[model samples]
Target: MKLKLISSIFILLGYNSFAQNAKTDLSDSLVKDKQVILAKYVPMANGEYLYKGYQIPIDSFINRVNDFRADFNAQIAKDKLSDLSILKEKDVMFYSYNVLAHYQIYYGMDSVGMENFGKVVQEKRGEPNFYKLIDSAQKKAFPKRLSNDERKRLDDIIRKSTDLNDAALFKTSAAYRTWLNDYLKGVQRKKYLADTALGYGGDNVAMLKVIAAEISDPFIKEYLLYTFTGTVIKSVKNAGAKESAYKDFMAGTTNETYKKGIMEIYINYKNMSSNAVSPDFNYTDINGKLVSLKSLRGKYVYIDVWATWCGPCKAEIPFLTKIENDYHDKNIHFVSLSVDRMADKAKWISYVNDNKLQGIQLMADKDFSSDFVKKYNINSIPRFILIDPTGKIVSGDAKRPSDPALRKQFDSLLK
Candidate 1:
């Protein structure tokens, strides 16, 4: 009796282990199958396989697409997940809907595509924005800026459209983020078209407030502030206006990341604002003597902030040389300040010597990190700046040597 009992216990334990292994095997198979389906069903020829002159009969194409969607949906049902712990299942559903929408639109089933898209926004777990996926299609459809009348027609169409709004979509859908980006761009473009000077610093501040008020969704609003703030700040030519816009946008958002970014930019703009005292620099000249901006006082200073590795900077060399020669006897001092790495100091010296570079050739002690460069927030090379006689900034972001505007400005200033 004891032997029989032991044998039965072992058999039961073995059976339970076998059942667990089988369940695991089935789960693994489901995940692999989901990946395969997502990979296999993407429409070809810009998702216009049915309509872009593929020569397929309309009815036949519709049947084939419907069958694929059914199979895809059936797989999604089998791979239904109870929680967000594993994203594979969620991805399966997302891609399934994505594929369905792609075909529906291309097969001239706009109403059906719109219906499925409606389901995507209301669905709780994953990202599902058809507009985000069909970016190329949208671009192809609207390749250039529309006239006011054309814009109104499209705007009316867009306004008439309706769907559920989900804030959580931003968390999961890269597509949702993309769609928001495009939408924000459209808003900015419309503002620009309405008044070409809308984003020039303080002008866009009210626009930002209006947008924030209009967009009740926090996630979407946060993203808009982040993107739109950067654009406003960069386009602001006036320091006072830039500061005001920065402070307003900063006050409006509690997002640490956005604030941090804007603060850095604000500091840069603040330091380089017109009429602000210019940042002082003491760098070694080509002849190895320290040349300070203070020493070259009582005259206008035109500083070309450049580097040896920059192609555009090199391209402007001839123009700069010509300007230097033309203004050789003028009150303005043309100073070419190179922000080359200290380790490449010899390379910079060699390039300047070989090229017979003109102007007061000087190099920073530390490439971009030098106090003056950092103060001016010089990131891209080939930047130009003009300082007044009293060590005040005339144009912290001046025109390039190649631009006729630069010469015109110089003529006006010198006169």
Candidate 2:
């Protein structure tokens, strides 16, 4: 938390050097000649604002972004910066708010377990009226030198861009959703909030609606809506509900890339969850003996889908080994499937031998794109899966060994 706050402060201060050494043009920086004009709606957080309320790290990020933009414009005036720099600055005007909205929802979610965030939501979780706040903030930050027409124009383009493109905005809005993955699966299983259903995006969407309404830019508005729409489509575990949400999002969206990507997430999960038949792999173990997922059908299988070179995968090994030791004599079978390249076979074996690795150490016939990996739509690792005695998937995307919940999952199955 302290690191985030300090980093945000630096983000505001670093631009000072950038503004003082402003260049004549940014044509070389950008390949295109055309400028993407946008509404510049910067949020402010005075010392009092922090002291009184909204003192969370997420709030600090938002405040820092607010201060950064203010300092940015001041520096532009100080150096009489170029149109290109000003355009670059303005194009990212809505970025901070977008980030703020993103993290605020993440922190507010029940699973994240941030108490201050929970308090913030409890105290102010009703209808959002961010426009009034923005209006008030802008009035205080206004310049006295500008003429009436100039002020009107500033208000128009800087706070309410006329050329807002929803499709274009969605292309770049992905960064905001990066922090969303961990909590999503938790939310889906009703493991977090009591009131929220499997696919509930209402908590985030309600706040987003207020933000979307407040944002004078059309693209920013649509972009927030997309967050709500895309989040629901991504969060739900029920196939039928997910399909419906996908169709709804696609029907309303115009961005083909965004549409295709969102649809693909849904498509990949289809027929790949609980009760689905586990994909079989005909591969050799580290001992040069052939083994397949089908051969271990009588006992429960705890499969770790990993690669030798993956740092995150290695990090989970200790905890994984502990689980194996704890349940050593049980009817459950533990296996580690390496999605390493065929060329790395020697290295994989060497590592297994060096570590004295427990469980079945098997390697994919090919690398990550092997048919078995592709069948489950595996992307990131180290992914874990649990399979029943009958070769049906218990959880295609099971909890990680590092997660405390993984033990509970194991107990629920074994006991």
Candidate 3:
């Protein structure tokens, strides 16, 4: 009887070990599969997308992404992967949901994407101590009073929150960028109307704070602060409000990584402040002649950095033409600098010639890598800059040509 009991004990131990190994193996496999799918859909470093080694239209690529999503969803359902035990695994659940969330948001299924995001948050919301646990940890020293199981649970929650925060932040940012691309291309679809309506509206800082207050995941709130503050710093024209927004976020979060990111955004904003010496560039004009900021130093330079593919940039052409005509004899040079990719240079040349685009039509040799673009932090198109005759920036983020404020500012400058 003793010999038989010893053999059964060893067998039970081996079975438990095998079960643990299987769980780990499956988690790793799921994570790898998720990453491969994400990598396949992510845009190239240059912002151009490729599908299966070929450059296809955005619409076609989105369709391919939907097909992949269908297959992934079917697999998950067939495997009954929504069981709480498996779903609690950070790598398996968060990554799988992230893949689905990104495509849904990017392809105009806003409600469905948000529903999935809420489900992830709702999972932890069931624990009555969830908010208290995170708040205590963030505000005070680690809780040594909790039992081992409680401590382990807290650690698990934090790890899962981190994964969910990162994935949501990245997916939302990409979706916003995708919306901007669609808007610039003039592709208005009924499906993306929800995204269209969502913008950094007036008083976004206050709006974000209210939304942050309701967020169940404290880490998600902190990460969101970082994202919102960066956008405000870069895009918000009101210096006072943007500065206040940055300070508010910096004060609220203890996350060192997020703090560093916000600081970098502030530094970049300050680098492009008014009256700073503007970054110079040399590029070939449509006439094949070279032009440089230094060469145009004796006159005020109204530089319009634009791309041929941008519909909004093209919309301002008529107004820009009027301004060029109005200020033709003034001590100012209207420079329309094209940031179209070098691969699209021929198309840019054709557009400029066909449209009779006025002013000094120049194309950057290195496109976005041109020194001026990097230095000025030019991420969006139709960016207008006003540099004084001495090459110091009058307004690094100048008013758009269509804005009455631009003509008003010009009138003052000319006088």
Candidate 4:
């Protein structure tokens, strides 16, 4: 009987050991998969920052975020934290709270999402925080900076604000402020990068290609490319460098929208060249008279493309009127083309008459996509175009009427 009992004890112990080993193996597999699902906010980089000369695994990071959201919503529906404890910060709890707070501030979602930001962000500013390594440029920008209890807090505040003037203070005081608010710093960063990459390049299309290729974030890449295109193409009098830039970009990308946008802008530059003839338009005036571009061929045309809803267009009006009055007797004609929609045709007529807008006032046959507007790809307005007496485009982007340069340009052209 004793021998039988001892043998049975050994068998039971063996079985228990096997079960324990299996449980350990199972746990190893479950941990990572569970963490990916339950975690919130993707835990904003542990203690590292990425800017220039670096890239992140954006696809994987986004996948983790999506997984977390799915699991979070499921848990919310069940009305249970499951294994969560308030005594310790769980990844799900931390993320949910922060996302809630983020929504409150940015999305006006005080009553929505998860607002646990109040708890996780309890670490006071200037504490041993996770936001990592300051760049060399940021360090130099704040040379005479005062020591702060929390420099990171100041950096965070300045980066989130919309005002550039408000940002000036942070530039001189905070560390790691360069990456804070990109809307303010983005243009400057790209210009510096472009200067380094292309050697103060007028080959904007080439510069754009370089910027697009270098940037990983889709939004920023698109924005930098688009913004620089305008600056580089504003002067259409010369197109040697631009032609090369355009060619390079065309060969590289398959993005249809980008291709279309760049192509239109390029065509606009060509259309507005001093060497190329201006795109003509014929429209009916308020007096029921048809005025055509060819009819005014002997005189220079300073065309103002505007609309009723455009605040910038309105601001230029007083200055434009002054130009009209000053140059009334010159061998020039100031033509105002209103791109106001058909719905606002009456409003356009009323505004023109009420303001007593000078020179030739004619309504555009169509809005921005009109044959005339598309010729110069006039995506934005208060646009001023200058044409020589022979109807050849002298400038696609002429000086604004308010500019003293406009008066100088007029005097030069009239002579």
Task: Tell me each candidate's TM-score.
Answer: 0.47, 0.45, 0.54, 0.49
> Which model, 1 or 3, shows the larger lDDT?
1
Per-residue alpha-carbon lDDT of candidate 3 for residues 1-415, written as tens digits (9 for 90 to 100): 2232222222322211111000011112332344455445554334332222222333454455555555556555566556432332333434433433333223321233333333333333325685554343222221112344643543343233422233333333333222222222222222122122334323344445543643455744555566656666666667776788888888988987778767866876786784677778889999889999999998899999888766456657778998899989999999999988899989998999998988999998877667777566565667898999999988878998878899899899888
> In model 4, what lDDT does residue 411 have?
87
RMSD to the true structure for each prediction, in A, is 20.6, 14.5, 20.8, 23.1
**What TM-score number comes out for model 2?**
0.45
How much lDDT does candidate 3 score? 0.57
lDDT of 4 by residue, 1-415 (tens): 2232222222322211111000011111101233344334344343221121012133343344456656655555554444332211233333433333222122211211111221112222123441221122222322232224333443343344333332222223221122323333344455534333334333444446555544555544544454555445543234655676567556756666767767877877776664698878888776668899988999999999888776557757878888898889999999998887777889999999998888899888776657787677565677888888998888877888867898988888798
Give model 4 RMSD, 1 decimal: 23.1
Instruction: List model 2 lDDT by residue over 70-92, tens digit each.
Output: 65556555545475455445434
lDDT of each: 0.59, 0.54, 0.57, 0.53
Q: Which residues of candidate 3, in runs, are more than 4 Å off?
A: 1-70, 74-203, 216-219, 252-261, 271-274, 287-290, 364-371, 377-379
TM-score preference between candidates 2 and 3, better one: 3
Best by TM-score: 3
lDDT of 2 at 18: 14
Clashing pairs in 2: 40-158
Q: 58 in model 2: Cα distance from truth in Å?
A: 26
Which portions of model 2 miss their true places by more than 4 Å? 1-245, 249-268
Ranking by TM-score: 3, 4, 1, 2
